[model samples]
Target: MTKAGIIYVVGTPIGNLGDFPPRAQTVLAGVDLVLAEDTRHSRKLLDHFQLHPKLQTLHEHNERELAPRLISRLQAGESMALISDAGMPLVSDPGYILLHAAREAQVPVRVVPGPSAALAALAASGLPTDRFCFEGFLPPKPGARRDRLQALAAEQRTQIYFESPRRILDTLQDLADCFGLARPASLSRELTKIHEDTLRGSVGEILARLRDDPDSCRGEMVLVLGGAPAPRDGPELAPVLLPLLAALPLSQAVAVAVQITGLPRKQVYAEALRIKED
Candidate 1:
């Protein structure tokens, strides 16, 4: 009996076709059938390499219904490949259903890494790359987005995000409020394309740049926002902190004062001591 087929999760180019890896092309041509997130989008890619595998649509809306059938084909020893509109199959895209099903059925699975928008943006931003995080997209709803931003207000790692072109300005405004206007950031758009641009500055500067051009925004944007400022020297404690401590318990008041005034814990504790005695 022939061995069960393996599922190759391939990553395609985000912008430039030149980003395609030769091994991915070879696998694309060799697969028994190619499952695409969108046939029309996949057509452009297949056309580039003259690959015409048996095509099937496997997007979010229809993935569950079609997963069992696709797995059965794989079980019967037909190797397959999956590709998304851009980038890898499952980074904020569909393919998870098929992947989970494959594991249950004991089929082999593999990856073919390629251009990732999050990585592309981060590498080009010139920000501190040693530590970073990828936040694919915030909640679409206004209230939820704000709540999330507030929760991340004190996060100290460089934050990376992928945003739709239309939401760029609004997201910038939100970031400015949460991260402060002078917070450094980079907005890279039309990446790897001829007219690609990366705007690097404080959040306010990016907002102004987008506002001035009006017509400049036309593609997805990768927003790399700087993280929270590191702890600075403690604020002077006596005048600002003592009065608040008067009504509160020693321990609770000092803790609250540390947060508000950025005062050192020891210094705040001492002020609380002096005030308690008075």
Candidate 2:
């Protein structure tokens, strides 16, 4: 029996051809077949690198029907590489069915890491990145999108999202309404392409700029938003007041604690008195 071949889930550059790594180029040149989200788009990339491997469409519509046959080919020792129109495959892109099927069959699989628009935007956004979440594209409908944002209103980690040029304004408006107009965010569009531009500021500020200069809204976009501020109440309130009360007089400490917590002055004063007594 022939040993099964490996499936290379390769990552192509999101935009700039210079970002395409040599390893990806070599893999594409050597693979027996290349499965792409769109052959026409992938062709230009391949042509630029002078690397031509047989191309086949593996988009969302046909991925399910195509998985079994592709698996059979792999099992028979024909190595294949899966790539999206840009960036990594299976990230807001197709190929999940094929990769899952390959795993079940115990076929070897590997990944060629490359550029990611979400990470790029987050890094450029000046937002906290130690903990973050990726929320692909949101629902298109106004009501549904607002509902989704409401659900994530209190998310403490930085959030990343993808939006199209057409819906960016509406989405930003909804985000401002849900996450608050003053929330810090960054909007990156065109990625590494010639027209690449990133707008960083409050959700309201970015929205205002887009409104003023509509040309800024053209091309693919990635939005990185600062997470909701941590709540200071109940148990957490004690730690805040205790330190202030120890360092300053009752009245001054309560005043500082109230400002820090953004809680009711009455509530903070009561807490301060209680801490002083203890």
TM-score for candidate 1, residues paired by index: 0.82
Consecutive 10-residue window with the lowest summed lDDT within model 1: 258-267
Cα distance off (Å), candidate 1, residue 140: 2.0
The parts of candidate 1 lying over 4 Å away from their true place are: 1-4, 231-278
How far out, in Å, is residue 219 in model 1? 1.4
lDDT of 1 by residue, 1-278 (tens): 11239889999999999999998888888888889988988998899789888888998999999999989988998999989889877888899999999999998998889888889999989888999988888888778887787677667789998888878888887776555567778999889989898999888788988899987677878999887666543345666666777677777776666556533345556667876676
TM-score of each: 0.82, 0.83
Q: Which one wins on TM-score?
A: 2
- What's the lDDT for all of these models? 0.81, 0.86
Q: How accurate is candidate 1 locally (lDDT)?
A: 0.81
Across residues 1-278, which tens digit of lDDT does each residue of candidate 2 receive? 11239899889999999999988888888889999989999999999999889999998899999999999999999999999888988889999999999999999998889888888888888999999999999999999998898788778799999998899999998877666677788999998999888999988899999999999989999999988777556567888877777789988886566545544445566677777777
